[model samples]
Target: MKTFTVEEVAQHNKADDIWIIVDGKVFDVTKFLSEHPGGKKVLVKMAGKDATKKFKQFHNDAIMQRVGLPMQIGVIGAEKKEEAPKPVAAAAAAAAAPLTPGKLVSADEARFGDGFPYGDPNWYQDWNSPYYNESHMRLRKVIREFAEKELMPYCHEWSEAKAIPREVVKKVAQAGFLNAASGAGTNPSVASLLPYPLPAGIKHEEFDIFHEFICVDELARCGSGGLLWALQGGLSIALPPVMNFAPEPIKKKVVPECLAGEKFIALAITEPSAGSDVAGLKTSAEDKGDHFLLNGEKKWITQGAYADYYVVAARTGGAGMGGVSLLLVERAWEGVEARYMDVMGMWGSGTSYITFDDVKVPKTHLIGKLNEGFKYIMHNFNHERLGIVMQANRLARVCIEEAFTYSMKRKTFGVRLIDHPVIRNKLGHMIRQCEATHAWLENIMYQIKTLPEASQPARLGGPVALLKAQSTQTFEFCAREAAQIFGGLAYTRGGQGEKVERLYREVRAYAIPGGSEEIMLDLGIRQATKNFEKRSKI
Candidate 1:
């Protein structure tokens, strides 16, 4: 690559001769100099024999090692990005018009036009996304603002302490974020598509709810996977069953309580021996006409430490899924207690082992119906998985963003490390994966929002299952890569540097939650077969 001066690179109109390829993420600095926020100083500092070392010095490791993947932020001038290489163009030659009007060029085009350096137009001081509509845009803005102000400020400290102030959760609840599908006059099941009845003109309200999800995504930027997981798990457990299965009287009592921060709920399914094997769960609820006597020990339950109510899945019949039923068990019931289960991540999520010693649950609190609890559980796993999926995607995004920023300012070997092709390729792949996963997730999310709730079936399970597997796996991969990129600092408790180190310790749990990778695959295979059979009209 021909080296150019800061001014030359900055003034690099399309006509500039020298191509300044900074740290390998690629940039067509050809015209960026004029548009840069820092003026020529930023580029000038990056000039000279090798600015890598100085660049490293200027930025933090988080940015250098974990800049976000491609296309998370809207492109400023995507038209000029250097395209990835094309396959051998054995195609008959075709001419193409260049921007210069009369200039003729070969039809072959690079996949990415030209990648710009960090701190370019497409960059955010942090993360940003351009979703489908105004509601999404507003939501993204709200989340970004919140992260910068609230979480970003205290994230490093909290990561070190492994404690998210209860105030944070309380504030989030106050923000009306927890009321996702079940707004006033909106039946809980109405959140589902297909047969679920819903009031007209509520799509916007639903869209607003998804925005709250954005708040959750941005929370990961705080750098504590465990904290994010602990907080979010409540949403996963509480929303679907309570909204769909709880009786109106129960809903009236609990929903408002949950919203008021006076109570919390969780869906209890995992047990000491039956972590992902739902069918093997030994939890049982025997009917005594007026109430059910339950006996089981549930482990690794998020919110277990504080949940005032639980959507408990129990063995109501004989064996397998058919024998199962969901019951809403209140904490006030006799013989119910939760013990803390210390963990590597999500420290304050109040994870615990919940024991039911002949716990008495009223018959009215049964979730869904007897022998039909499995379907209701199945009904919401996809949404739960997607939530996991988004977290995984966002976690990777954090890695990329932090790494990229670090790489830009950190100088090593006399230049910004990003100028190295090897580093760029490594970081580039991370970016690509995150963006691809995000795109895939957004597509599925759109479908879930618009598809009729009635049409959701066991067959639909396959897609969500596949996504759950893919999302967690993707997150784990990116986290590892980001760690490697950060080198040493990634290993230590960077204390307050948005602890990527902390994330490494927490990555394992992400794979475990919302059903382990193994369970996801098994469920995916079964659902895929069902989908295939339906497709064949079998």
Candidate 2:
């Protein structure tokens, strides 16, 4: 058992302090009298001495079980706070493209030291970050406002209760963000880029249009993971086929309601029978004169419960890939049923299992050509994967920030845990992963911004798919690491939710969503091969 000297204790504001070394671990017992799980008398006996002997005597494994886990034995001590560098407030820095116009620049600027170079690994400082556009700046202000004023106060409480008020949703809708990529009633002078949802065409505007990505970034930062996913998912559902193939009447009816936030839509491509193998789905929609009878059950549908319409996938042809088709299914129509699903995370996100039992959808709502839903769904998968990538990045960011905070406060061995080399390694590794994810995401964002909207996904499919798979995996890993770093605090969740706790469940969904990593990799490698072969042929 290790003991602290009186001179050493008094030097660090220790007056009538008692220190105990338990299981070869030293802890300041100053604040642990009542808080200690082993009862005050037991701890008070060896208040000023090392409690290892008594702890062993008291433990004997039987008492260990009674006192919970090893982590609950909280450590207390003095900590040397690292002064946080002042954030630059220059409006230019705030608005300037941090990376290619739609990317995130890590907040870890190493101006204070060598390792802190912006965003962890110091890998992306050389990469051209264009996230500094005017709209990017404006959106940042709006999102910050939303997070601090509108979302923050209630976030912890709401997150714990697993509920978010609908009024907040209405406010987000009114903010015109659900449709930021498309210009719909949005002030053109302020949000000129809104008209183009996916950054398709318009070379200069498209190249510089960073606002669209910022909308998702800031919204995710709003503390309510469920809300961000719901809103972002809705926007993503609005972007794909409607922008490229839907007729005017159909587009007008379906698109505006989403921007207005009155209606909801979800892309349903995965079937329980054929999860990632879209070509293997048994769900089919048969032509019935003026309509199609969509008979299928789409599992893990995000926003399934309340979606006004579904960007649904079904088999319409013979077999394999050629037979797939994407159709719009409105909940108002008969035979459409949605059942709320209890998922691991995103509790208020309204995910569900949807069944269209001979549901009739007008031919007008048919997306693209009858046998072309495969292309639409495939093309749309890129953006969906990118969206999931964004989620992964944000989850990593939350974990890093929370862990950094915890490290500074959590004490061990008479000093702050962050000051320990081993603890710093936890942060260092997570940071490296963070930088990698941000860099890859930004690179993809740049490509997505420049390509003509007509074929952006096809052009960047390989990289986007690979990054989506990697980023989600990264999210899951970081969440787990964070949980371990926080130890006991992460498991007991009665207050502000542990990010790892939320993300642990959330990240798993990402692995399965969009497409599984194994599928993403196989598909991405194939696309990449084709991309090179075509380039060589050209």
lDDT of each: 0.62, 0.64
Residue 109 in candidate 2, Cα distance off native in Å: 14
lDDT of 2 by residue, 312-397 (tens): 88888889989887887788888989988887878777778988897888888888898888887776667667777776777777
> How does model 1 fare in lDDT?
0.62
Give model 1 RMSD, 1 decimal.
12.8
- lDDT of each residue in 303-388, candidate 1, tens digit only: 78878888888999999989999988888878999977877776667788999999888898887778888888877777777777
- CA RMSD for every model? 12.8, 10.1
**lDDT, residue 534, candidate 1:** 82
List residue ranges in candidate 1 displaced over 4 A: 1-131, 181-213
Once fitted onto the true fold, the runs of candidate 2 whose alpha carbons sit more than 4 angstroms away are: 1-131, 160-163, 181-209, 452-455, 533-538
What TM-score would each prediction reach against the true structure? 0.72, 0.73
